[model samples]
Target: MPDAAPVLIAGCGDVGMRLAALLQVHGQRVLCLRRNVAALAPGLPGFAADLADAASLRALPRGIRRVVFLPAPLAREAVAYRTVYLAGLANLLDALDEPALQRCVLVTSSAVYGEHAGAWVDEDTPPAPLGFNGAILLAAEALLLARLGESRGVVLRLAGLYGPGRTQLLDDLRNGTARVPRDPPFYANRIQVDDAAAALAHLLALPDAASVYLGVDDTPLPLHELYAALAQQLRAPAPGIGPPPPGIGNKRLRNARLRASGWAPRWPDTRAGYAALRVDPA
Candidate 1:
């Protein structure tokens, strides 16, 4: 990493903005990079730099000591995942001009744990990806860690993200797509979008941050229970009980490590996060 104080936020989006604000307040200069420069909020220091296009990233601001890469996939398929997550990181690293870059933070997914079959997962668990998303992300994670030799790379495996403007779960319940699986319950884990941002900032500030961390909230609830609660709140018909669709399974994720570090989520559970969406059923 560079000896300078410049921080690079690649693929800056909602979480990126949160990190940018924290870094700025701490008296560090920050640069935001995304595929579309116009999407960047006004007054933000950013430019259009696509990780797919290594050429465009060649001119990324120098003197960057730390980098946080959090890019959304361009498509839903495996190929798209490869392009954005794997190829993107490869291209970004290859194009960096900074030699003082000390640490690179890569935001991945808990899907990499695949079928833990209702078992709890932590940072040290060996990843056994069952699905394509998990496999690809695991591949990308391996690429980043190997490239940086683990010491200078941190992989944050984020759970499902939700918050304001991210009302997909609420929408699912309202639209009757929410399900209540029978005997076997599919466990769900998550972290609020805001907390997701805060976690990244917290990791960046730590001098001895672990190379891998599970970014999850305090509670890991069953999908059936979560849906039932949401349905009752919305005064909608309770979701019908049925078997889970293929590819979904039960798995609990623990964030004891993150909480022990003094970073706690503001919305710890379904109740706290969805309380606002509880419209009067009258």
Candidate 2:
């Protein structure tokens, strides 16, 4: 496939937009599909189409060589979690009929590993998702992997992501209202948005079959320690720490698979990423 063929990004959220920008900078054509075109940054080709609508998606621009499936946001109060998640993915997979499509990268979450407490979990680990969100992600992974043939498909299980315009933990710390789970210091992993984008870029450039890679930093930090450091950087009050609520616990994801693929994260840990955020306040 030519390097200039448009890469289709299904959902143009924070990470999706950043990935599109990086691909655009590298002179790759980026076609972002979303419910709202206004959400995409200017100058990037965007199509205002709903993934829920199969017909509209089937008509995507031609010569799209790569597809990045970012999960669409669901209603917090929606009663049909499985239906929405499966239906959206099914529609997209059905819509693509282009024989030239060579690569597909589906963004799954590390939540599939469930609450790891302090243990390191990798791609090979058996998925034991805890809640509905985790269940849905695992289901999605199965769906994509089942349909993925020799088209160089990939499943990227990303940890908690934090970057510009998408900073919940940092924001909470800066406001001096950050809360930690009551359980003992449990480990959590994260990837800087830019590093995540870089990993995707690297995977796309590779000539291979389907693979499952974990997207996480080298070091996993306790949730409290990360917030504490953030509070110090912001010069705000040391935020109050509490235990994770009943259902929500800590998780540590291993990135050895991706690292072994010759992709090293610029920010290998939450502390480093958080510090950089303070310096530039992203």
Candidate 3:
């Protein structure tokens, strides 16, 4: 990676913005791209483009060495997933100048692994997506590698993302609305948003990064156990017995590959991550 070349982060939202900050702190030039450039901080360079519309991405910045595809779907439907993860990703890759591009990292999800029946999953685990969201994202992952080749194409399969603004778990615990099934032992996997961003930064600088990596933390607890831990931390009542959260798979992810790459999360445990959020909700 050239020190003077800039890293372009497509779909610069909360996590993307956080990544840009981390890259900047390391003396790397950063450029952001998203639909709403006005939301970006003052003096931050960016471009306004809708990934769904290929024509809108024609004016992308040139000489981009590293790219991060991190767009979120506009809706929860299958069409939304296809449009953002598939069509949007295709559009961005087609529009970017590739001569200078060294790597293109796609921020995907662990949902692609589908339900694992409380078993452990790793990068080599075959993807068995169960729903439209996971299916489309899996397709998108294929498309990225097909377009960028194995060396340049990289995927970070992140688990559930939570941080300062994402407080539904806390609210549910406080309101006594949180519930999970205890008999089957549905598992939960998650990584703090800041840690997620840091992982992205870590992969960007890796010279021989693998084609895929699971971006989870050190622990994957059963849903009931996680909620109980959070409730204990909050001094609130335990969650009730009910169906597990909809649309997520039951699996435990291992971060050994990413850890072996010399990138360990600052908060390896979700409990400590949440505690930090409580102390400094920035």
Candidate 4:
């Protein structure tokens, strides 16, 4: 493989770390920017910068050819979601012009297609966000798309991500707080962290300009099944089955667009993904 361009990962969280590792393995100079630089790999170059402060963003090293923008934890809260989303993105964009940056990949979520009750959501699916989080994500998508026309950029709408240090269900199970709603037929999509990282690497290597892709596995497992698998894996007592609360049922997402892009997932289903996590929890 040819040497990759200098890449900057804005958020060195679980996904960010995986991306950074892969970029480094591919022979790219990676610079990670995050509030907690200690969380990143010790050998990787990282910059401590507050996502909310535009001035701090200016400190990002210039001559960055590629960038992966991962939303900070601040985007999770309902109230502060939009402010941080818009402000953080705008601040980053203001820090550098497109001519100086070769390409950018914005990591977004499937929440933009909020509450997909039995409906299959894909890249072309119109966003119908329900709650504040989804609304903010949708707004962020719009802003990113608007800027995409001006630069070589793409948006990756990822499914529920799981892998090393990010076992969402496993974490709940270990804490003895795994909640399994009684509602049957309620399923959700997921993708392993390694798969997500590979998808990003594939996009970065492609010669294409701008595109929107859904990063998800082939199977969308039922919520109860997911919890039960975790319980079994951990040898812990399974949560009592109960009816799923209103508006919190199965949501399936389609990744036909991404699959069509010549990138195949190593973990095509959640069962395989979860099975791989059966070893040490750490």
lDDT of 4: 0.75
Off by over 4 Å in 3: 279-282
Q: After superposition, how far is residue 23 of candidate 2 from its true place, in Å?
A: 0.9
- Candidates 1 and 4: which is better by TM-score? 1
- Stretches > 4 Å off in candidate 4: 1-5, 174-177, 236-238, 243-249, 279-282
lDDT by residue for model 3 (1-282), tens:
436978889999999999998888888888898899999876578889999999999887677779999997899899999998999998888888876778899999987887778899999999998888888889999999888887589999999998879998899898899988998999889999999999999888898778999999998889898888888878888999999777677789999999999999998998888887773223
lDDT comparing candidate 2 with the true structure: 0.76
Off by over 4 Å in 2: 77-84, 181-183, 245-248, 279-282
| Candidate 2 lDDT score at position 220 | 82
What digit string (tens of lDDT, one per residue) describes model 2 on residues 53-83? 7777877767677888885656743345554
Q: Rate the local accuracy (lDDT) of all candidates.
A: 0.81, 0.76, 0.88, 0.75
Q: How many backbone clashes does candidate 3 have?
A: 0
| Stretches > 4 Å off in candidate 1 | 1-4, 245-248, 276-282
Each prediction's RMSD over C-alphas, in Å, is 2.5, 2.5, 2.0, 2.8
Prediction-by-prediction clash tally: 5, 7, 0, 4
Looking at model 3, residue 126 earns an lDDT score of 92
Rank all candidate structures by their lDDT, best first, as comma-separated numbers.
3, 1, 2, 4
Error of 3 at 45 (Å): 1.8
Q: Considering lDDT, which of the candidate structures 2 and 3 is the better prediction for this target? A: 3
Winning candidate number (lDDT):
3
